[model samples]
Target: MVTGLTLNLFDFQEKAVMQLLDLTTDSRCKQTIVVKSPTGSGKTIILIGFVDEYLNKVNSNTAIVWLCPGKGDLEEQSRQKMMKVAPHRTTQNLFDALRNGFPSESTTFINWELVTKKGNTAIKDSERKNLYDRIAEAHRSGMDFIVIIDEEHSNNTAKAKDIIDHFSAKNIIRVSATAVENKRYEFYEIDELDVIDEGLITKALYVNEGIEDNVEITDDYEYLLDLADAKRKAIAARYQEVLPEGKVIRPLALIQFPNGQPETIRAVERKLESMGYTYDNGMVSIWMSEDKRDLPENLTENDAQPVFLLMKQAISTGWDCPRAKILVKLREGMSEQFEIQTIGRIRRMPEAKHYDDDLLDFCSVYTFDEKYKAGLLATMDKAYETRRLFLKPKCKTFTLEKEYRDLDFDGLGEREVLNRIYDALVEKYHLTSDKQRNRMILAGNGYVIGDEILGQALHGVFVRTDMVAEATSYYGTRKRVDTHKHGMQLLHSTDAIKTAIGLSTGKVKTILERLFRKGGNPKKKLLALNTAEFYAFVINNEHLLRDEFRKITSGMSQQLGLTLEPKKGVFHIPEQDFFKYDPGVKEEIEYLSNAYQEYTSGYATSLVRSISEQLFEQYCESRDDIEWVYKNGDTGQQYFSIVYLDALRHQWLFYADYIVMKKDGTVWVIETKGGESKGKDKNIDPQIENKFNAFKSYAAKHGLHWGFVRDKDNRLYINNTEFAIDMADDHWKPISLVF
Candidate 1:
């Protein structure tokens, strides 16, 4: 019945649920278990699955108390998800449960603030009596209780901890993305990489390059706003490009102000209005104290009208909006530190796919305070469990090569091959003697064919050689012919071929003999042959063979279908590890020295490193020899990394910048350097030289060309060649000159 639950859970989620259940059920395990899962990791679904499984398996009379932060719409959302999983069970809120006693099969969702408040405002005398009475009744009735704390980090205050301790539940399961450690509980940390690898969230974060080490707010407020606007426009453009036809999605931006003061709110609002953002026009929605706009229950839900949401720390926790791709923080002071909950608001991908564009693949944040930026980066590093820009390579490159050799076809033409096949079939079917036929008949009736009977029947047959070799290799068997005999006996014993032919083995054997005889034609040897004749005459009929063999030997020929053809003797080369080098590489290389003019192509670009790299990209576009030039960070561009060992034997992964493919099927792996260059050294930096060597080695192994280009003073260096070739002066050269 637990398997009947309709929640679509990822592997990690299911594992988390199972772990909680195991700890709860085992008497030796700890009573309190903490599950640490990141935001957007579907913690609610896991909880639902766990609760449903526990109730259905352990005790139907068990009660669950789910505690969430604040009195917001999250309680309702949690209740709805729980009901979907266990419709037959009852779900109620704490306020409702205060009036009605706890039901036998029910879950109660309570706000943490309700019980954590001080004095009479906490639980009224009547409410306290109701809760205690329900607890007493449940204990008397031999019912179990479970308390689940959601976002446990937020409610770690002394009052909250006291409220959790007040509940006399059998088990406590705490869940949070950023869990604070406590000595009273056992902790389980879910790998953040698992979530990112599963494509449940984005892999990296991208911020504006203009943010400096120390920023002045008064001087850069307008510029910060403009940068935020540009980021929003870029996100919107990307959404338009990748969204399905006829479907529209308006990306939202969250602007977190410093505080909720009226003066500050009004000032920010006036500035936004001048920038064409007004609540009257539906361009902006406010969630501050002064202007509490009636927003949708879930802002991430489709059809929400706000393009910009202005707030001051209200929707940071217990809120999810996948369309929120941009964040603009107007920092007033150092009071606001970057927290994991703040980053989680925009970490989720709306459709769970990055659309292969850097703009869409990353979440951007724009802030004016330098200290706030540093704190945010540090918090992200801790939350994601990553060091500074720890890159995991996502692409691999392979090339195709050819090898020439003489193929041995056994010196046989088509007709001769058919003759050899016929001979092999005759020996395989035991048509050489009557004793062999009797042995096959006995084996078909479930009698084991011993070694002597097998050796006599399969003495001259090589038809089963390949199968015997493969079976012996897989099973580590030395008696190869024993495998063959067992195969033949199993095949003949099944009713598959007999049922299809609707004839007895004696008659089928007679037909097979006439069909496989030396240069024999079925029409001449017997009545005119029909379509079904080959169904039984073919010794290697895969369907009949597999069905028959499976009855005796399990898991044999399960993947092989009904058509089993004889193995040919041709020496054909397989595609694996075959790399092809271009034969016309000399004519395809072009040198441009005098005709270098920057050309702009109407292609969307992002994360450009320098002006020279941009100009190099333009020059690559203008050349006729270049089939396609992929700039780094472009959508659908190939990205790859190579691992090289340093002198100390430490492994380092280096990513290539550009991949250029020529029309004649040649590829160049290029790394562009753009800074003030050391003039004509002809000696690349040792580290860079090591990477170049690694790249060249990988390219040669994969049959791809490799190059290192220096875009300084409008000159290019192919590999380590000493020629200072200009893109403006055009000429042809051999790619081998650099190699």
Candidate 2:
């Protein structure tokens, strides 16, 4: 029963198509399907889903054509790549239909310029070029073209409608990973929670999203990616297979902003050339628009299609590309339309019954630091049809604090309360930081910046409000309830949020930070650390987490006869106290706990001391250091609760699950957060992260060794490092977070 299905951990396209199929209930109405996914979620695959549906059967051999905004070598190459990425089973089935002359079943990807550009055949070698005329004539031929507008939207409707006229397609399929709908075409949403359960796609979907006022660059990208070994392998495999060896590809990336971008492709091209990579021999060519370089009047496919890249302010819509494998975002985020245009270039082919393994097979993307400016990822999620980036922080999104208070607790469905509260606090309220984000309120219906505005808004919401007070002092804070029970409360209340949508927060320190720049300083050139130390930091903090687990469930702890204690930040778990539980439960928990013990932390019933020692041994590899300690938990007796886990601090002192000798004078100092509940009224318990940051500051003030990091938008980048963005996608956040 739900009309729209929620997204799943996997099988994105399958979920979408199934959602679309549900529309069969309204068989009487001819509906234009509008799908909203990120730039790489595979909308093309969904478009192909209709190649032949047995339930709502639409039969025809001549109803398919593709459209796009450009006619360049890259565009054509993109088309070829798509054909190869389609799922094998579906492609085989579609291939059989294509043999029958069915437009949907038939396969063909051509350049719009090839069909739209007209030349005077009347004269042997026309003195003048009628390239535009040739293209028109081609369209007038009325061939079997089932129109699949790859980048269909208000901006490219003219071209799309024209193609629609020519094909008289039995079925019109518009596939855009980033779709901006002029009209809310019939929507087909998926069951997000059951994405993996359905088993329609592979490896589940992953996503990471947020809207940083002005994004910064950082080294977090490399670190986080390292953990996702399987994903990285898949990406490497796909890249290796597509780009031919000795192709001089160097695996580069590019980003394009709608406007307001400082650097142009030409500028980058010059830089690349200066970098000694300008010797193009057919394989390395850039595409240009309106400025046609048609092989000097005589060119052969084998003779290198001029081996040149094309530069266009904007690519045409309804374009087709099969070889658009790896899209790189080198540009900044300016407007949703422009962002969509860039991502649209590579999302042309669908994985219907026609081209298996080749349809929507785009595996990975490379993005420069700057593409995240102005909350690009979040904005695009609202427009696109094939991708998703969780618009919230991972930990917060998974936390279910508010439900504990409301009687209905209904246990807060996994995706509902947690996703709602966290996504809003992090994305809309900007609660992760101490500063309030500056929203440059874009004007007009197109959401373009620097345009004259009748009026403007921020975060796409709010009428008349500003910074609001939170916690210790007045700063823009997220929704909070002054409750004593929940450790995850905010200083700001839902009531406060309701009273002042836009004006209240203007008075907080968050607003002041946004209004005034702090005294700046530059500090670079730091010592390099490896991955082992990082794991050590996490392992050492294990006790804090277990203790918090204890605090939140003391009753259950007592019932289970479980008592926990921390030695050197490592918790001890008892064994005899464990096996006393239900046989199945004991086995499962033990299995998971033992695996953790073999590596890091563990939790047991009565044998807390022994279990803790064993887990510590596992983490330390039988070393004397207690999980590579900072302050001995056994000595202090005085300790703060673990409320927050500052991701960056641990990153700085990256001691791995492995070991190393304390190099005479080369020990890294990293800060950590006490893992206590944020508490009732302070929805955001930033104290933990703040302490870590403070620790870094102390180290900096004393000329010591330490750094800081805060996890936002699933991944993090540093400041002063922004890039022009073609597009940003969080399509893989969900899958990764789950595993």
Candidate 3:
């Protein structure tokens, strides 16, 4: 049997998960680690690695709890991986061990279904008892207990609560594909994305998800063929890993004819059959002769064994296959979610214990990159968002190693932030451009083509070391020849121009090309890193950024002690985060020892709270507890506010379950959980409440609103009113929050 899996995270620090894992090996880190890897990011593989370590290194008394939205999907995927695809210590050994009776109260895989039932209701009695018995007995028997929860966010109903409570272990680990704010525990992260911006998953080609509408397709069959021709090479390129050792995987043309298009399934099926593939549905075409019309009926089966399944349909959200090495999406309008799921299918670790020296096969075949280009870009947007979201919820705070003040290049000496393209053309690409530096590159792409107008020495140094491939050895470094390749644009900027000024002679060609394209002047100067971030902001997100910025400026956020979570992209800062500083704050301290609401968390406060608490103690240290006067700028009221800096961010920043306030009462006594770093943008439209709805109870809670309110006290009142009104209004139309 394989001894154990070792995840050697030596000196890698690109994304958040690395730090998270490094810290997890320690037992005191009770902080919940929310690894915000985008779909297809190999979240499962990482999890399995962690599980393998915990089971062997920790205690066998560990019982794993796996919560899934769909019981069938969960069992199928897990079983398939364990039996068919897992690499180390064969599944047969596991089955043999299990079948021979290793003891019922031993290492196990459990689903929350033990607590949930039909009708989307919960199982509160027998099921809950059975689950607890297994866990408690297992733990009592000196068995280690580990829980791996899948689709954790779906734990909304009371039944799921039964399961969560049944486990009763605070160490229950949750796994989710979406970017979620943890605010539940300390945070760590891992980013599988090569370049993180708009979304997560990346491939040979990058597509931003938001620009779906910009992508064009045509009704004419010729258009498709023409488009396919453009992407045919790339399509074949997708199959490189799967191709036999020496067999070149070339694009197999897929000609879609209206009626025949549906028949494409049969065509692919026949091809796979010839290639020795089996369908999970189990209709062995070699033996069962099903007519074309009855192909679906013939291929349908409830077989138990896993098979090499080839599905043309976009994989659904719940697919958890360890053996799924390939995914081909035939339709368009592919969302980031779809891409993430497809990527996730192949990323799961092989159940037994084999790690491929080569990364798994991930290839996408599209008629044209143009069609899904925006969606792909949109994917990056989501990935970035998901990353930040996941990290925040996990309660991660960073000091940037160095202070932003020190990191600032302010007053370093103002070099030209703008330069023209004339000198750029002559010196850079060795081409003359009548159009100056302030022009667009490649027309539509956001680049400014230019020669090394600012000169190569300085500018060349700023370019990432890996930006250009080295020239042949005999010739020395590769010439920075003019390139028409599409990529994330560097665009017009002061830093870009200044850096361009110093570009090496070899890199002039690219500098000139970029300056000329984006109407950027090369002689003036290029923009700096932060400036570039501002200028290259996504259009659809401009208003969002502006709104968030507005909230930061608004005094209410300051009054409430809420700060802008820049990394989390679009969350509007609530008033409390800005204004609710523990009165115990002092000079030189960047953050508080504990959040003001720590008093309500039930658990002891963290170090962040202690810093602020120390200051408070200076004021009223001897007193068991103390209250200070608090002001609510929005409601035009003032009242006493209690403090215990140790509270989590959510306790005060999030909405409350209920708050009781008599007309003349000074304080808003409230209950319920606080929110994490950020939540998704929710829209509002006025509506009336129903009789049975908890209108009375809801009306009693006030959560702070971003830019909409002012002061910490305002939060208690604001949160109460916001959700109350939401529950009352909101046209029975629920939001999907799909992104």
Candidate 4:
């Protein structure tokens, strides 16, 4: 845990931080890493945690350079967030770096335009040292730079690359909601669903929700603003009901105008003023490139004053106004592509949590532009109008067996991994304590060992033809390849070894030192190479070592005898669960709650079931013998699960799809999947046979009944006797007959 932090990061954020630390600390990792995290995922907090963890774990002279895009004073905003989250750490800026060389173990936030743009005072040659000079000084002082490019897509110009090159960064992490994929860098994406699951953002984004298709868009601007204002007022009322007594939140509506639309802006202003929102009062605010009005310093707070904000593209990137829940995008003559950044502004929950109120938990967008709506939906798949449903009241006494892990078990630790690697090496090479003999054996087994590492260099050229400007067909008249000795770059030879083997820098070092360090334990030390010779040997045999390590890692689980057994305990279904469904769907079941759309007898869940699961649910509800059906959640302690071992012997919990309580006082557990047919089984899941066998064992031991259910050709099949992939197998029968 990072000390001196004001806010505690969620599990997903902490996981991202650990991944960043692993990449930055490992010399074998890629030079560039892209973080494709969704907006409102607390990316800044994750990076700050990474920085603090890296500094604490590794003993090295390191500096973090956070380069923010030039918008909304994002650099300063990021700096303040860092200070608030980690006040104990030293945070500085470009000017501060100029006055003093890049401070070690500190973060320096720099606006890219300040130093990258030509003729900028910070970049100009003056009495004060420029950014380049400071970077050079930091390098001279043995600082390892880790650069973070926030909103990297916004400023991916040649100048930005040039500025980044000045730092000679060991690692460059580019962060954005819409990060582009590049083969040269490793990608780390935080699933948007995870953020929603954590309740950091709205459950869904509704566009033109509840607007009848028959309605004509004769007046696009006023109609959209009217809808937005009504929704905002409704949300404000919901906030009053859900929030604490002293805490207040006024949901603000943002009206976005396309560039060069002065008349349309005035018309919207008049419309807003008529709706009790005006500049004269404190309810309205406008933020533009040159014009600003009634804006408070802290608009993100719950009790901020502004209830309506009008903006034209200035707050698109890196703006954090959580209370702004409604967006009314008014169009001009030209059609504009709506960026996700604009919608992202309203996605964040004001209190960083959902109030379980549909009116307050969902963000709305009122836009008539088809192109803009398409663009917005293209970015977020879950953005759509949804109607709530509650759990039916008839199934109130539902109970099911839930699997829980044993707290005392700690299987497959780092020590086991290290031992397995060591054993694999010894078994493959037939190693002994005799260092000279081991060297001979290694050389004979295709392992290169010499003063210089041997590598191949290729030289070729394409032949241009008159058929095309640049010929697509290439013909190399002369193909030349020569062997060359690895140069002084061998100094970082461990980097190649670690990269090849997919291990951390420290783990690689520890393994190497244990195996080859001079004057070490005779039993463990298999190689007798000094520090210099060890590096050369590693560089020469990087690929061979990588292959061997890959084999060991892939087979590690198979070699280990680790398995999980569920404890003899069970959890029951909760009284309520939240549910959302597309409003366009006309089928409304009577069992769901009218007020909150909850199932009183179902397990706690916030998931929208898949098509197969929904169909299976409908099947269970229609059955005469079934008393009630409770859906099992995919994860968490509140859900029922069965411990199963995968083919690799790795332990995992199998959460069955539904638990059926029959009228005969018997419980039936069913796992749903697409049935196999002669045509194709595109939805088939791997390693399902293992889960079926585990479920069978669990049922027998606990005196319960279980079945594997699959849908094939509009018919449901049950396999309770034997696990088989073929639908025609003797163990399979129709679900109705089995029930």
Candidate 5:
């Protein structure tokens, strides 16, 4: 049994675990299942869940061998994590497992080095009898063995293959972000976009665009180190701005050196000293082959954590730290090719959610080698279906039209609104200051006045129910009726009245009898009061009611979900696009393609796209005839690439873009074109002509308007003709022209 720890697996994590278990247990399922989950997707927790679920189904004890890819630290990390999930089960090395005769219900985490040594020569004869012989004997004795290979890509070598072949296990599971292709294993990939959308990791990778030019003429190592320092400072400042109260986060910059040579290490030390990032000053820590310095302890409680981690390739895999957000690589002796494992170190959000600032919401990589940078981009293009390796603007700014202004609602007076709100509340809740009646009403409607007041009301009600149930226990069929009648009569009794309202017996009795008439159902009346509606009305009118409403709703306002909607009349248009172009956003556009490559202004074309969207939205709001407006990507069903006959009598598929719907039953298909040359060219391109002809045919058949929008020069060409309309100055002109 697993205990003493709470596991909060996200939706994706839970799904991955169930899928893995299904693959492992099916009678006809493959012996090996590959789980290709992205970095920081909690692969360790998924492993634990798999073990737990597997154990529950089997009648006998099963042995699990977790093969990790590194030496002592990786093994230790696996053991600690497994212990948290299943403390009662044994967690040891191969030697211990073999000595114990492959103990049932035990997990042994062995370093790949232990089994992958050359010629199987690493194990001595005496130890081989205990380790290898014991495992082989256990297999022959019908004990089930499950082997899980972590970082399978890095460990999928000849020696590793030998180790797995020797096991001859019942099942094998390989887990990694980047899986090696094998025909024998069943492949399952977790959606990377799903992980990003869940806010489990950072959104995009940001790279320096000018690094190529900088690397050609400058001392590459020194220039790249300076850039790393700048990024570190910028990230630290942003972190401080959004740091939650009572939380300490020391943003870390991970600098990866090629190898742990003495001169290289000394050079990095001198650079750190020059930058005021010395160990004694408490800003730098080193992790290398020869020396390992412990990271600052109590990192969550104190701000003494090192700001910079200088190390070689050792920390690439199996190192988990959320605070490492910046990765700097000085490719001295390292290969020019990019590997995904290196970037995985800095991908996790320290708090599992991005900060409000855009700068802090992304992980950055600074490298001076142009060849290496290009290699990284190529790797990213292949690994992620959507291109995420790109240079992002440091800041985005939007231009606003003078006509875009706030709506006026001052004509509707506060007193008039307050009176309507009060009436609505009274109709729903039966406005009353009486303590006992309000308590009953609040209870029936799921609202609490106060814990003290609610406790007293509950105790009084329980006592009355107990008395009624006891008195009517003999009247089997009439029990419910008898209880209601007795409970109501008890409310009018002298002791009940005194306990409830501290009033005189006669006065309290008179009030109770008046409130509950002879033919009126007390329960039915309480049930009709709608607390949610009443609370909403009170909250919306709080500005008018001021202190009076605050006193009435005091502690329960927040619980009722009655947050006042922003004043509807005063509309404030955001100065920027809601879907801002962050390097972290998953959507991709091919900027290097011919259509976009000619526009060398760098983000100017993207800015034009943003402006086009804004103009459309503004045009929609200003016109009363416009019913609905939708961007091309808003709905998957909005556009149809349909086959149609062109003017040349050839069949073609029209690629539709944006859609505009008007009040008088008319739909317009708007295709936006970018680039000044495209807009200015007299002769339309064949591709554009084909699409135009198809659009015209479809619109004529369906009775819709087909138009073209040149975003570069803000011109509109309507009715599927070469004749253009100059509406560049006023985007609203389209409403009049199209209609």
Candidate 6:
């Protein structure tokens, strides 16, 4: 029922659009939902249609935020798709929002890195508060934001979560091809078979087609290239047969090579040139970090000139070339984990409709790497298989008190943490602006501040042949690896630092150079080290530096004049909640005459059930005094929770398993854990003691009873105070008395 939309939608896409609208506009207070579909299912177009319909039908003042991952330039790609499909709608980016506050009924696209990366000018303290100002301005205008996280699986980092929380959006929708099942979000899925039925994607994927299974692996890359080229030509010929004389379609082949193999690249180029596909004739193109060649303006079009494209790595996520029908992955001895997105590159139909011809309808892959093939199949088996479960109406009245973080107190940002770490190091290690003095002070405190540059060189024999030339047979292992005074240097010290600290290279470099650079603001600089000395020091002491950084960030260093207090507020259980599961698998739980509903649907059923939970559910069902038993979720904002402090004095949320109500107007909270034996304690949860104490304190203050339950040899035990892992301990008693 969407009007004024230029692009026509298929039946499935239209249904999905309507489903999205209904779910978002429902009366429940649920905040998050999920959309799972295959790669070539036109998910972008479907979302654009939903946005257009929502802006037209709804009356509220609203804005849409489309969040994309930093990889692949996906934000720009999504913006272009929105404009091309719905021309009348208003579209903008982060810069536009900063210049002029978020307009009503507009869609804004933002890349995750711009705000999450440390030292990024967009959110750095030194830069103007553009993002915060725009958010405030939007709030003043009474605009509600609906956030959409595209490719949700790839954007689950802590910093990404922080950015999403910063927006304080009214609703969130996550879209991905391989979305996992969570009890918090309402699930929707578009069947891959439906897409194939609609002719939007290829019918099937043919791996190593027409090759004998018993053949041996060969190092010759020419065989796979020859097969892929022949397939591309055949598909192009089929396209010629179907279309008119004026319209033409040229199918392209993609060749992928492993990284750091320059000799193989040279030989492949020569082989391709012999096959009449050369860079001089505009028939070949390459996409790499250091070199790019002869790429057309729009590579997705069927009539683009390049017939063969070469690349050292997988293409970006949003790179869509419908004319790409074949792939030739050349391996160099080592195994690589194939990415699912790479296979999706060749799966789209050129005309968005499949011809009946077998060669044209199927995509071809000619790779002799069995490991890569196995990995691809393993990833492909878990393709989007999802089912939605409705909330039972009888559970509307069951509510409990919970805890949430107060939004008024935004805890420490990355820059603040970095500052605190720097201050702590400066005071403890007696760092100064003088490099030599600082180095001596650090060395005195057991820091590895060596100024020696070290490296290793491989000594090998050079060999040459008519087809290829390379080095072979390395010798003098320990003697060739010599340490010199100052001749050798580390090439990728930034990368090494990133690996040591588990952060982005940019962030690591910023932390190192900003704190120890030679010429900065005199008051802010802790040590004055030039480029060479700085690199040498960091590379030599990478592990020690990483340990120091983590200790401060993890709240272990307390004398840095910083107080860490987590903001807390009260949380209440929602009136309605949903469950999700994969329908393709035979995993389901059914309960009759349940308190929440007549039965539980889509509740994950496992072959190995938790002994405590199984016994407890049966006990409640059989007892006549029990009024009702409500199951609580493990995580998410919609569930009941209690605030607890860990050993580190950091606040955490504890969610109990069951909330039981008795006919005598008594309520009980229970947590389940594995029981212990006399010889060895078997409980594995590290925070068991902390959670138990918190539960007791909360129940006593709130006028409710609580107990910790465990299972041992088909029997149940309950402990209220003084938790002990051994079942023979006097603190534990039979569950019959508690019931």
Candidate 6 clash pair list: 402-571
| Clashes within 3 Å, all models in order | 16, 171, 148, 8, 1, 1
Each candidate's lDDT (Cα)? 0.54, 0.30, 0.31, 0.68, 0.53, 0.67
Q: Model 3 TM-score?
A: 0.37
Q: What is candidate 1's lDDT per residue for 245-294, written digit by digit as tens?
A: 87767778888876765655666677778889888877788887566685
Look at candidate 4 and give me any clashing residue pairs. Answer: 389-597, 390-592, 390-593, 390-597, 390-598, 391-598, 391-599, 392-591
List candidate 2 segments past 4 Å from native.
1-10, 19-26, 54-62, 65-147, 154-171, 180-184, 190-251, 255-285, 289-739
Runs of candidate 6 with Cα error greater than 4 angstroms are 1-7, 118-123, 126-129, 258-261, 312-316, 369-739
Find the candidate with the highest lDDT and give its number.
4
Error of 5 at 170 (Å): 1.8
Window of ten residues with lowest summed lDDT in model 4: 458-467
The alpha-carbon RMSD values of the candidates against the true structure, listed in the order shown, are 33.1, 27.9, 19.9, 29.0, 29.4, 16.9
Comparing 1 with 3 on lDDT, the higher-scoring candidate is: 1
Return the candidate ranking by TM-score, descending.
6, 4, 1, 5, 3, 2
Runs in model 1 lying further than 4 Å from the true structure: 1-6, 119-123, 181-183, 212-220, 294-298, 369-739
Please provide, for model 6 over 1-739, each residue's C-alpha lDDT reduced to its tens digit, 9 standing for 90 to 100.
2334445787778888888888888968367777876778899998888888888887448889999877768999999989887888899988887777778889999887787776776656533366776777888878888899887655555566656776788878888765554545677888777788888788877765655433332324666787788888888888888888889788989888767267667778988998999999988988865667777686668898899998765363667888888877775532344454566678888888988987888887665433322112211123322232334564456566666543343244446545766787887687776767886888787654434332221122111110011222121111111123111223245665444334456666777777776776565566677765666666556657766764444333132343334344554434444433334335445654245553343343332236677677767766788766767778986677886543333456788988887888788889888885555666776667777877887788779888999887778899997867677898899899866
Candidate 1 has its poorest 10 consecutive residues by lDDT at: 454-463
- Tell me the spans in candidate 3 whose CA falls farther than 4 Å from its real position: 1-25, 37-45, 83-107, 111-114, 117-125, 139-144, 154-158, 180-183, 193-203, 206-314, 318-739
lDDT of 5 at 323: 80
Per-residue lDDT of 16-128 in model 3, one digit per residue for the tens? 33344455567777634555444544455555555545555554344554455553455445544543334542222222323432242233443445445564344445544
Candidate 2, residues 360-474: lDDT per residue as tens digits? 2322333322222211222212322221111112112111100001222122232232233333334432333332122221111122222111111122111111110011121
lDDT of 5 by residue, 1-739 (tens): 1332234577787788778878877888888787777788888888887777677665246788899976436777888988886676678887687568677777888888766665565566677656777788777777788888887655655556656767787788888776534444677777766676677677766654124321232233455578777887888777677777766677788888766667666777887898888888778888777776755664322265688888886666788777887777765431233344666777787878866566776777665322322111211112211111221231112111111112231212333323333444456668564536755764566553221100000001111111211221111011111222233223323343233222345543333233322333442222232333322222222223333222222111121222212111221122222222323223343333111122122222343244454444445556777654444432222223443322212233344555665677576667654324444543333345445554565567667686665534454333455433333434324434764
